[model samples]
Target: MTTKVFTIQPNKRLRAVEEIMKWAHVRHVPVVDERGRLVGIVSHRDLMGAAISTLQVRISEVERLQHNAAVEVRQLMHFPTATIGPDERVQRAAHLMRSLKIGCLPVLEDQHLVGIVTEADLLHIVEELPDASLALRI
Candidate 1:
């Protein structure tokens, strides 16, 4: 779980998201509302999909990028997002992610965004755990 999270407003431009993602080196960004509540979430996949959809026959790559920047974060984010509590177990989060086919989940506390847990974070935790081995009885 990453305690330091980067969030974006629903009205912010895509370019802002891209810049933050690039600077923070994060793939998933949570979208917050005016009250700092988790309203939606955006991933690199979502941005890529938006970018691909904007490709036109006569449009140049630069134009497509600019067009994407004009689009608001709310337009590209996935709403009604699934969130987890800070006290929830890691296994539960992992199961949710696997079943939902999501890369990460925002952690909320009392309806407020707190942290984020990603697949990579889970993998890292597993890697740090004690090794397991089988013992055979003859």
Candidate 2:
């Protein structure tokens, strides 16, 4: 899990979100409210999906500009997000993510965003397991 999580405001433009994602090298960003509560989540897949849907209509500069200008984080985010408590077991978090078919989960405490756990994190954990070397031996 990464404690140093990057977040975004709901009102920010989709173009700004794309820039942030690129610069920060993060695929998922949690959306926070004024009180710093996790409200929603946006993923790189969401942006690409939206763009693809629009392009399927007609690929035009004017249409692209309109799409970029009109879209906001609030409109693109996945709402009622599934989250995990920071104290929860990694296995539990992993299970939830698998069942939900989500790539990541925002870690929260008292409804405030604290961290984020992704499939990458789980992969790291698996690699560090005590018996990880056994697979190579066999």
Candidate 3:
């Protein structure tokens, strides 16, 4: 189970997204509604993809256009989120991530965001566990 997740609102603009990514140094973030329900996820990949596409259309035009300085979180977020309950087994979380092709999940209790689990977090667990690096059966 994961907890202590970071999030943003949907409809946020890309420039604001950059600040959060830069300040937080996070690769991904969950999007949530006003009610705090999970909605979508935004990853560094998503931001970079958007940035690249924006540039590809017309590099000069993009360069001339200034991104919004006061963009809200909602303006630049992804939707249709993937989430899992906090009590679910770690294996279940792993399965959801694998099937969804996502690296993270917003842990929820009822409809509220609670914790977050990521692929790296899972790996860290293994690394911290007793003899987790070993390849042995007892």
Candidate 4:
């Protein structure tokens, strides 16, 4: 089903990202600037990547903070984000994900971030072949 989706603005601080993750229980957030233009995408892993290498911060402190920790989202986000349009078929999404080695796709319409689709979304579509045992000739 085609639909619009979650988005965040660039002016929003890192703490906002943390809160969004907590409230929505989502791994990624699409970033739009003040003008409603998509600028980047941030994921939980991206935050973790930064947290892991924070030299001054004790590693234990990061672990203790857990998912609730609020850091600057922009500090950990990936820019020039990859995107797909809503009209695109699921197959294209799968192909792009595999080829690009990415975990999620931000659906866009007219350069605006729309719904997000991940590998998990596609997994539900996999169907078993009927009579697979009979077709097998090992």
Task: Tell me, by TM-score, which candidate is best.
Answer: 1
The per-model lDDT (C-alpha) reads 0.87, 0.86, 0.72, 0.70
What clash count does candidate 3 reach?
11
- Where in model 3 is the C-alpha error above 4 Å? 53-65, 68-76, 136-138
Off by over 4 Å in 4: 1-4, 52-71, 127-138
For model 1 the local lDDT of residue 121 reads 98
Q: Give the candidate order by descending TM-score.
A: 1, 2, 3, 4
Q: Tell how far residue 6 is off in model 1, in angstroms.
A: 0.4
lDDT of 4: 0.70
Top model number, lDDT: 1
Tens digit of per-residue lDDT, candidate 2, span 55-113: 36767778776777778889889874588898899989989999989999999999899
Put down candidate 4 lDDT per residue, 1-138, tens digits, no spaces: 234445677656666776687787777778878776778888877766655444755567556456334455566678744688989998899999899888788887888766788776776555433455345466
Error of 2 at 128 (Å): 1.2
lDDT for each residue of candidate 1 in 71-95, tens digit (9 for 90 to 100): 9999999973478999999999999
Cα error, residue 27 of model 4, in Å, equals: 1.0
RMSD per model, one decimal? 3.6, 2.7, 3.8, 4.7
**Between the candidate structures 3 and 4, which one is better when assessed by lDDT?**
3
Model 3 over residues 2-72: C-alpha lDDT tens digits?
45566777776667667777887777788887899888778888776556354456555445235444445
TM-score of each: 0.87, 0.85, 0.76, 0.71
Superior by lDDT: candidate 2 or candidate 4? 2
Candidate 1 lDDT trough over 10 residues, lowest sum? 129-138
